[model samples]
Target: MSDFIGDWYALLVLLLAGFLPNEVWRMLGLWLGGGVDEESELLVWVRAVATAILAGVIAQILVLPPGALASIPPSLRYGAVAVGLMVFIVAKRSILAGVICGELVMLIGKWWLG
Candidate 1:
């Protein structure tokens, strides 16, 4: 088991195969995206849709999470979101600050309650 796990050649092959498709598209996008207007209406709509999708996924996770997240109380998850959003708003809508504070509150709640 250890020999198979430690095989560098196999690891390299797996990593390359996993990244090849996405990385190729990313490289192509970098090459071709130069002419795209950042402020275009289509781009703005795309961003909005992407953000909405992300929010939907986060809501699903908090409301009906699986495995380890399921073990944590739902109320705690809701609290984490509330506090995180509050932090985000209080910190002038800094996404990083909100995410970090929300995660910290969840972790602390888990630790303190147990």
Candidate 2:
């Protein structure tokens, strides 16, 4: 605990690094939101960009994860996602059901494969 406290600066640096990009986007949204209409081209562009960034992040996590997930096959990762989406759709788009099903599928796949 003392060692962890002594490394507070490192933690602060990491937290800032992780936060700055999202903070910039949040600030941008606030700045633009008051004047922009939902159907406007600028808003559409922003939405597209945000969606692309989110998709890229998810893709990277599933395809090139670090730690334990890195050991799992890509097919299993994607299969879990597909099953999760199916569960989400079948469960009236409940995010909790989707996430739980996806994680459970992944865990089962990992165990079976291992």
Best by lDDT: 1
lDDT of 1 by residue, 23-60 (tens): 99679779989788889998899889989999999899
Model 1: runs farther than 4 Å from truth? 2-21, 94-114
Q: For every candidate structure, what is the RMSD over all alpha carbons to the true structure, in angstroms? A: 4.3, 2.8
- Model 2: residues >4 Å from true position, as ranges? 1-20, 24-33
Query: Judged by TM-score, which candidate is best?
Result: 2
Looking at candidate 2, the ten consecutive residues that score lowest on lDDT are 2-11
Query: What is candidate 1's local distance difference test score?
Result: 0.91
Model 2 Cα shift for residue 50 (angstroms):
0.4
